[model samples]
Target: MHIALVTETYPPEVNGVAMTNQRLVRGLLAKGHRITLIKPRHQEAPPAEHASLQVHEVFGIPIPNYAGLKLGLPRPGELERLFEADKPDIVHVATEGPLGFSSLRSARKLRIPVSSTFHTNFQDYCADYGAAFAARWMMAYLRWFHNQCALTTVPDPSLIQRLEKDGVQRLQMLGRGADTVLFSPDKRDPELRRSWGATAHSPVALYVGRVAAEKDIPLTLEAWAAARKHCPELKMVVVGDGPVRKKLERQWPEVHFAGMRYDEDLARHYASADIFIFASTSETFGNVVIEAMASGLAVITYDYAAGKQFIQSESNGHLVSLADRQSFIQCTESVIQEQSKMPPIRAAARATAINYPWSATIDRFNHLLQKAAKTEQITPQIDIVSNSEQSTL
Candidate 1:
């Protein structure tokens, strides 16, 4: 099947969206499906063209106050033209941006079946931008936009109920997976542990993700501080970089900042850590939490969305009620103080992550596509206006 994926962000961005979408697209290719990736062009990108898979580019403006990121504006004519030439069997939008909305409208214009993925909490993002009242408007717009698609996929099931209550239509439960091979305890290096000031049996607490405002990173710092109060021998390590790096480094001078990592280095960081602390309540799915667990690190996150669905409290990891700042800190302390009894927790954490394989997730997605195509009434092919100069699809 020919699938066109539209998103504002793609590879080299080093965020959840880029990493997850890369896995999905690569999985789709391995499953013998054709994918046309449509995204905003980065500065000094490979090219506006592609061979194995088609790549349609659009002018991107820097996201306000987010210098490292670029947001796609409407490229309606360009998309319409591309669709006219290389008609996809289905259109999948991975982000809700100007490019996404343009694809939705163009797909409707051409009478094609389109699908969407709920990858971000756009409404919450509005509040993060100091426009709290705009959240309702954003939510309403999301309801309208997603309702136009034949299927809308969300990574977390609990979000389905919430979206349905808000008048969303035809939601699909699509979960993501972790790379266990790259995230296992075997990757833990004795030398790396020593670098973090960790002894053979000392606890090494770690956080591996973007350090941003919405991540509630201050709470994580507090939890670590609480944990340290109980276990003075504990070593703290942070393996990712973001806007908050300078402030975080200054705030905790003793903690190790490994900075942004990828490939084997990232794996080593995950494996070396004894426990993972994630305080974010804004994620649709906690990719790092699963990655940490797959690496055999006990996880501590909120009891909602990703964590609540996978964690069974004392069984695998700790899942405190959302925004329970004090409880979260106390839980961290408990784990560190009682660190000797962590074998069962670590084992359970690994076992829980075993089922989350990219192959399985992609297989289910393929099944959903087959089902949708079989059940959906076929629409007549309409040529999308394919003028290279025009920027709408």
Candidate 2:
């Protein structure tokens, strides 16, 4: 199968969508498939080195308030030429950016099957970015984009239901997985823990993700502060960088801000922590939650998406209601107060996380692409020319 995967981001970008795309592309290549990977280029990273993979770089502009990430520009003319030369069996649109929009148009014009995956909750992000009024318009555009594809893949059932309610057709459930081998309890380093002023007996609360408004990072800090009141020795470390990292670091000088750790280093940071707090409500599926769980950290998150699917409150991990912000803080404090139950909870989390492997997710993704290629395409009613010319959100 020759699969042309189009996205605005890819590996060395340190985001969930980028990492997931890399994993899927590698998995497909391993199964003896040719891949044409098209994405926005990053100066620090080179094109993927694979015999079966062909990478095409495109021009992009930096997104507002998002540092180190680019919004890929539409290249309809270039894409049409590329498709004409070596037509792909299927084109998978990962991100609904300008580049992805152009790819969809090109593939449709060439009469090729196309599929898309709903990765981010851009509609939910509107409120965080002070553009709450645009959320409805965002959803409308999203529905129009995905409805055009033969299949629209989502990470969780909750998301599938939400999109269906919003009138998105051809929806399918496709879950993300954690790398248990790389992110295991065995990766725990006592030296690293000590650097964060944590010891064997002392607890280290960890938060790993973009330190941005949408992540509800303020809630994580508030929970950590409240938790520290009961257990004065409790330490907090935030791993990952974003637009607000500098401001947050200055605001909370006591907390350790370990910026942008990747691969094995990222796993080590996860293993060194005792508790993981992910308060973000806007997620298709929180990849970090599963990774933290795989690293044997008792997680505390909202009762939805990955948390609701894998965690049993007070068993494997903790779950708070999305509507109750106060309850999240209380839950974090209570989890810290009961130190005796930590080992069992952590053990259960790791055990459950190991069950979900990347291999299974890859197999399912491949099946969806193959199935989509055989299905008839649905012509979208929206004007592709107008949409492609519009500015990227």
Best by TM-score: 2
Q: List the residue pairs that clash in candidate 2.
A: none
RMSD of each: 5.5, 2.7
Q: Candidate 2: deviation at residue 138, Å?
A: 0.6
Error of 2 at 75 (Å): 3.6
- In model 1, the worst 10-residue window by lDDT is 384-393
For candidate 2, give the lDDT of residue 69.
89
Model 2 lDDT tens row, 353-384: 98899999999999999999997766753554
The reply for model 2, stretches above 4 Å from the true place, is 74-76, 384-393
Candidate 1 lDDT, 150-197, residue by residue in tens:
888899988999899977888999988878888888898999999888
Could you tell me every candidate's TM-score relative to the true structure? 0.91, 0.96
Candidate 2, position 102, lDDT:
91
Best by lDDT: 2
Error of 2 at 23 (Å): 0.7
lDDT, each prediction: 0.82, 0.90
